[model samples]
Structures are given as C-alpha cells and as structure tokens.
Target: MSDLTDLLTVPVLDRSLQGALKAALNGKAKPPGALGRVEELALRLGLIQGRLIPSAARPVLLVFAGDHGLTRSGVAAFPSGVTVAMVDTLLAGRASANAFARVVGAEVRVIDAGVAADLSGRTGLVQAKVAPGTEDASVEPAMTLAQAEIALLAGARVADEAIADGANLIALGEMGIGNSASAALLMHRLAPAPLGDCVGEGAGHSPEGMARKRAVLAQAAARSVATAPLEVLTQFGGYEIAMMAGALLAAARAGVPVLVDGFIGTAAALLAVRLAPNARDYCLFAHASAEAGHRLMLEVLEARPLLQLDMRLGEGTGALLAVPLVQVACALLSEVAELADVLEAAG
Candidate 1:
C-alpha cells in the first residue's frame, strides 16, 4: 500500500476471547504461567482465531523466488541463475525447505515473482513475474511503482489462495541472489540502524566482498529518497521481497498467523509493517538469523524470535522449523486436559 491507511480495512485480530483463553491456560493442571511462551503463543493464536479453540494445524509455506539486477554487480557469492535453479530444486522436493516441511508436515508452494530466466514450463511454479527483475538499484530504482504494485498484489493473491486451501498458518520464504543487499537497504531506510550495521556477510560474503556490498548499498540508499513505504520498496526491494511484503499484509488481513522466516523474509515483514504498522500484531518472528543485521531488524521491531539457530539459509526452512511449536501451542489450548475438567468429571 502506498499509504498504510489505505489498507486499514484489513481486520485487526479480535481479542474478545483473550480472557477466556488465558483462563483456560491458567486452569490447566500446571501452575499459572508454567507453560511459559507456550501459553503466550496459544493465547495469541486464540486472539487471531477469534475463539478459545484455535488451530495453526494446516500450514503452508510459500517460497517466493526472484533474480536481482544487483546480483550482476558481484554482490552475492552465487550467480543470479541460481535463483531459478533453486526454484527447480524446491519444485523437485529436494530442497532443505522441503525436508523441513516434511518435518512440520507443511506444504511447500513456490512462486516465481521475477526470476530472470524463462521458467514457463516448470510445473508447480506460480508465474507472477513483475519483470525479469528490477533495474540495478546502484544505478537506478530497482522497479517502477507499477511493478511494485504488481508484486504486492501478486503476493497478496498467493496468501489468499493459501488461506482458501485451509491454511491457518503461513510461513514466508524466498530465493533471490543478492536479495540480502536489497534487505540491507530496506533496513537502512526504515530504521535508524547505520548502513554498516545493517550490512552482513549474506550467503558467505568474504570481508572484502562485504565491504563492496556496504559501499554499493550506501550509494543505493543515497539515491533512494522516497518517504512513502511503497516507493521505498520500489527503489530497493527484490521482487520476491515485494511479494512477501504483500503476502504478509494479506495474511494479516485474512487473520492468518504468519511464521516469518529469517533475514530476507524478515525484511519483507518489515516492509509490511511499515505499510501497515498494525500488521506487526499478526506476525510471529520465527527465528533470529546468523546474519549480523538480523538482530538490528529484530530490535527495530522489538521482536523476540522463537529460535536462536545461527541460520542464514533462506527457504522458509527456519519458519518451517517453528511450525511444530505452533501446532503444539494449538494442541495445548484445544486438546490438553484441563485440571478443572478432570476434577469435575471425577466428582
């Protein structure tokens, strides 16, 4: 959304049942607050569901893939083509995300937001191409406002489809070479974090490589002057990131609990929050990444992630790892036998 006010029609989570949800948690056999974050998570889920009975049981992970013009500038360790190749790998169900989805029993959905290469015939690919990719932000705005709009709309559509398919929990993920550079720029714009502090050795950049990235990104930031959130997204965001931002807002709009992945996905969530500050209430920060800037972004949002795995892998794998926790939280509220209920039945 160009202005977050435009998207305020998206419903905020109704907390009418929070009292009952918490009472249920406290009434369990364990002492009050004994379940720790588990109680908090369950209560949050109930608030989102608008009922004491909640379920994040049927979850879907959407992996948005794109190629970045900045990848041509030697910003990333791998070639831009790897973006497309990795999509193929994900479709083959051999990617790390796929393995983890199996662990959490979540379905994986891949969307081609703006991959540079032709992936027309690829089965299991959602072709929502905004462009082959955006122009190199170091040289020019990465995308037109229209392109950013398209990406945002496409992302929202993906979330709508997921929700339609019985998905109550959605995890965000992406594959875009040099997207880390894009994410770093997003952080510098939205937060007071210095550009150097936001820069990280994404995907194994060497010390020298990281310096080059920091320099290039500073220029990109200087070139970008848009104060509006969508304009900022157009200036420096990757297609996959743009879509994820849209998807996150859409998920929040649909009242679906979002399991946000690390770094790149977090950047998307960051953009969504900037567009709609209330969207933050809908997201569950999945984990903190190994990336240095990740903590900076997390701090900006005041997000406490569920896991501290030093992982920088971007395929929604981190978010997938957190899915079981969500399921267990749902089970705690929906299936766990309460102390009062047991005692009443025995009496």
Candidate 2:
C-alpha cells in the first residue's frame, strides 16, 4: 500500500464556530440571508477558516495539464498535442484562465502532470509529470497503481506549496485532451452510473464520433470491475484528474477552501471525497458544467454550484470567475457592520 493513502486523512471541519458565524452573517446590515448564496458562501468560508472573519487573499489557481492516450482510441475530437499548446498558452498568460485570474486578482500556475510531450524547463510551469500520458484505458489500465499514487502525492505537494506561499484560497482547473473521456470513465465506475449517462460529446463530436466515443468508453468499462476510489483512478483516471484529487485532499487537510471548476474538476473532487469524505467540506462548486453527466455527478457529491453559464470549458476558467464572489463573501463577514451597530448609531 502506498503511503499516499495514509497521508490522505482529512479531519472534518470544526463546526464549533458555525452558530457564531451564522449569527454574524444574520446580524449584518441587510436582512438575514439577503445575500442569498453569498451568505452561505461566507458561512462556509468562516467555518473552514475557524473564525467569523475569513479571507480570500492570495488566491491561486493551479491548472493541471496532461494528455490521455485514450485519445489514440478515438475518444476525443482534438489531438493530444493541443494539451501542450494550451500549456504554452497558459504559461504565456494568454489562456482564458489567466485572463480571468488577472481580472479577479488571483495567480495562475500550470502543472505538467502528464502531458505526452516533454515540458520540462518551462519558466512558470510546475514539473510533476507522472508519465508522458496514460495508456489507453480501452485497451488496459490508464496507468499503473504506482503511477496513480505518485500523481496523487504530486498533487498534494503542489497544493501544499501554494498554501505555504500565502494562498488563502485554491481554485482548481485542468488542461488535457480527452480528459473528459477519462472523467467520464471515472464517473461511470465511481458514480456507478450507467455508462451511457456518463458519456458526452466532449470537445464537440459528430454523431458518428459520439457513437465511437461511447463505444470506446464502454470498452474501457468492460475492461475493469474496480470501483474502489484508488482502483477506479488507476483503471481510468488521467494524471491531471489524480493530481486534482490530491490537491483537494491536501487543501482540506490544510483547512483551505477550494473553488472546484466544471465537470473534470468535479470528477476529481468525487475521487477525493471518496478517498476522504471530509474533503467535501472544503470544496465549493464553481459552476454547473454543460456536460451531459455533470448534473448527476454534482448530485452524487451533493454540491450546489455558484454559477451556471452553461460552461464546460476546462482550465479553471470557471473557478477563477468565482474568486470575486468568494472575496466579497469574506469581505461581507469581516468588514460589514452589524445591524445593532447601525441601530445604535442612528439612535
């Protein structure tokens, strides 16, 4: 057994401050819960931070980039090389995630979890490649169990480093061709949903292409009966997915809140929550992805996403878009005056 599993124990959030946090939010100048989900957000942040006052200072978005050998099995519409291209775009600060990070005052770092091409020596990218890319799951396990363990540990360390660098909040994203296929497979086995329900037109596919994708995924499913979290990950998960799962576990262990992006990110969260249920307490769903099976995945996780712009693009773009809301939620709790104070001042 890998030591990574032993290190994944996430203690439940200390809810001892829940009542006081709720009281503080209720006593804010506006009517109780007027901020709607924003109030809920503040409460969650307060609970995670263990104080009435919470902070979103130094928000960091870690975009894990990898490639999937499943692409060779005709599972994706784009070539695997796009993963490397997008990594370049992100490192050049020209990706959608980077642009959103700039507007919301967050930092973006791309991690090369398992891109097929050699990406070492990149100035801004973090090096944590588990393999060039996973093997085709339609033919064999996506990666060895050992490789999966390494990827999980790599993700945990990446997140820990961000927290050490003053990141009060972590927003997760991913860049990988055919990862939606990997996510769909992970969801199929872990969510235990029907394979058809988990399959979607990832990156846009034609009718024949979609059929081919479904067939390929069915083949992958038939190849394995492993439903355990780590087993499922080894059987079907991409390195980026495994790493995101690790990042979530590490963030929960550190008591830092995480902004989970769309379908792929949620799949990673599902794997993490399965490994350590307490990790769910630290995850805030960023948006409802337009992918076919995402709603069901969110249902299984019992998460309410903050936004739903029909977004399915991966790259932590949705997570970065939610950063301002998190900051506002923190500010409302830490800076807004109480109703009693307002009444006293008026009197």
Model 2 agreement with the true structure over 192-277: per-residue lDDT tens digits: 79989999887899999999999999999999999999999999999999999999888888889999999999999999998898
| Candidate 2 lDDT | 0.92
Question: Which window of ten consecutive residues has the lowest lDDT sum in model 1?
Answer: 1-10
* Clashing residue pairs for model 2: none
Number of clashing residue pairs in every model? 0, 0
Per-residue lDDT of 96 in model 2: 88
Whole-model Cα lDDT per candidate? 0.88, 0.92
How high is the lDDT of residue 320 in model 1? 97
Measured with C-alpha atoms, the lDDT of residue 277 in candidate 2 is: 87
TM-score of each candidate?
Answer: 0.96, 0.98
Candidate 1 per-residue lDDT, tens place, 156-229, comes to 88888999989999999999889999998888787657888888888888878877887788888888676577
